[model samples]
Target: MQCRLVVNGFLSSSKFSEIYAWLKAAFEKRGHDMTVCTNIELAFEKTAVTEPILFWDKDVTLAKGLEAMGLRLFNSSRAIEYCDNKALTYIALKDKVPMPTTIPAPMTYRNIGYTHTEFVKKAGDLLGYPFVIKECFGSFGQQVYLAKEPSQAMSIVKNTREPLVFQKFIAESQGKDIRINVVGGKAQAAMLRRNEKDFRANITIGGKMEKYTPSAEEINIAEYVCDILGLDFGGVDLLIGSSGPLVCEVNSNAHFKNIYDCTNINIADKIAEHIEKCMDI
Candidate 1:
């Protein structure tokens, strides 16, 4: 079998390179020929091929084009779009999965910014203090914030130009969260991320990781979330709320390097196998 691996050209980094190398090797080991292509490479192409695409980029336009060209993408363009924005992810899974009380921030034009503070106050009032504020489109937990007071929360909202969401912060889950990797409707590997010094438990933000065995319920929710979101493979971040597990976020193209370090699980291999099964290779 032969496949095209599509990624963003400008977003190249050491982490991305490493993951690409692993995935390429994994696919090759399974008797598959994987060719790495960037969005730029297909920018002017007016032809279509019969090979499947493993899209690793957030370039929705390019992904859609490829799909329309009769190519099957691993996660699909729709799934990637839904997971790219936190608010969209919340909306897509709110009814299908357990999640925090998430409210999309009121729309504000980038040029005008927040013209008033009333909406921010309203969000603060509803979510209460220590609420979670997250940029709709972000990664590595950098755009997530824990607003301790209404004033600070309002300030954070007023200063931002990007779309955001306000969520009920689960106090019990502070500094910790579980990341479950789901592939082909199955929970594959999971790890617990903890940051004693920060409320966010993202490994990129100095969080520690440990191999974790998820509960049956966690596994169910993780896989179900993927099924509903049309994700071929992803990482579901869940918070242990007082009542049960509440979804924190979902990653369409989830980074697996940290989880590999913790669990010694090469998710790339699982991904390759899943793709083979999916494509009937």
Candidate 2:
């Protein structure tokens, strides 16, 4: 299997490389020819129309444009676009899973004749304090905020200059969350992310983790999310709210390194195997 991987802005665009070195090795271990490209034009020449394309970027060009060019993509462009946008992913899965009470506010969060207290001015009810505000395009919990008050929320809104959504702040979580990694519609691994001091519990935000097991019900919910998106792989983030596990977001390209380090799960190999199967099909 000869392959070319397209990455727009990589995990490390500088002196640090070896971001996808493991997968590259996996492909070569199976005797597949490989190439990595940042420029689509540079990659297009050697690529066969039907050959498998593994895209790590969100440019939509490699996934949509290449698929239109008759390339066999591991994950479709539709899946990437749907998952890339936090608002869309939430809307798509809100009804499918037990989800947080979410309200899509204006990107600017303007008064618009609404009182500062109303936040919506009569359009909608004010939601949880310390609201969870996520930017439209982000990853690794980089664009998340824990706004303890409306003033803080407004401040964040002013700074980001991007559309945002607010979800009920889950006190029970105590700045902790769960991430379930699914491959081929199966829950491969689960972990609990917690930070007693920080409001955001992303590992990148100094959140700590431990090897945690998921209940059968949790696994079932993760599977349901994967089925809803028709995605080959996913990392579903669930907030253990007062009710139960309420899904907050789903990521198309969940990094396996941390989960891989914490649990010693060979998730990369599983993803590699899954991609190989897609190529064969």
Candidate 3:
């Protein structure tokens, strides 16, 4: 079977490129023809799609267009949109899944910015000190921040001109979290990320990772989040809460290289196998 891989054109970092290469090679090893193209390359093309598209980028508009053209995407466009926005992910899984107490920042135009931050005070009052503030659309823990006071929270709101969320900080899970890579509704690999110097436990930001075995509840939550978001595969980050595991974040196109290094499981290969099962090829 022939397939096309769509990646972000602007992301030229070797970290991003490495994942793209591994995915391409994995598909080829499974006896499939894989062609890679940037989202920009197909952005204005008016041609109909002939084969499945392995969308590895967060370009939701392009993914949606391809889906409208009768082409199947591994993780559907809707799924990508839900996972792309931190607020939307919390909203979608609000009552169904265990997660941190998250409140969407009131809508504000980028031009106007936050005129008054009274809402930030309210959020701080509700969530308390040292809560989390995350930009709606971000990855690798870059846009996530911890506010130790109302002043800091308001500062974050004023400085950030994009959509965002206010979340209750899981004190127990500070500087640590679990990443479960789920494919085709199953948990394939799990890793524990630890960062002693930073609150965020992302590998890109100095977090160390080790292979982990997830609890049944953790695996179930991870799989259920994917199912709810209509994702064929995803990486679910879980905070080890005092009560149980709380959903930290979900990635529609999660990078698997760190998990691969920790677990020695090539998630790209599992993704290829899952795609074959999905397409019956």
Q: Among these predicted structures, which one has the highest TM-score?
A: 3
Distance from true location, Cα of 38 in model 1, Å? 0.6
> What's the lDDT for residue 213 in model 3?
93
Shift in Å, residue 128, candidate 3: 0.7
Candidate 3 segments exceeding 4 Å error: 46-48
In Å, residue 256's CA in model 1 sits off its true spot by 0.8
| Candidate 2: residue 233 lDDT (0-100) | 82
Residue lDDT tens for model 2, 1-281:
77876666445643214446765776777777767666455355534445577766677655777877787665567778878887777788877789877777654443442223345322223665666777778777788777776667666665665666777777788778888999888999989999888777789879998898998878999889888877788788888877688887887767777888789886667767788777662
| TM-score for each predicted model, relative to the true structure | 0.97, 0.87, 0.98
Candidate 2 wrong stretches, greater than 4 Å: 10-16, 39-50, 107-125
Q: What is the C-alpha lDDT of each candidate?
A: 0.91, 0.73, 0.92
- Winner on lDDT between 1 and 2 is 1
Q: Residue pairs in steric clash, candidate 3?
A: none
Candidate of highest lDDT: 3
TM accuracy, model 2: 0.87
Number of clashes recorded per candidate: 0, 1, 0
lDDT of 1 by residue, 158-212 (tens): 8899999999999999999999999889998999999999999999899999989
Arranged by TM-score with the best first, the candidates are 3, 1, 2
| Candidate 3 or 2, higher TM-score | 3
Q: How well does candidate 2 score on lDDT at residue 179?
A: 89
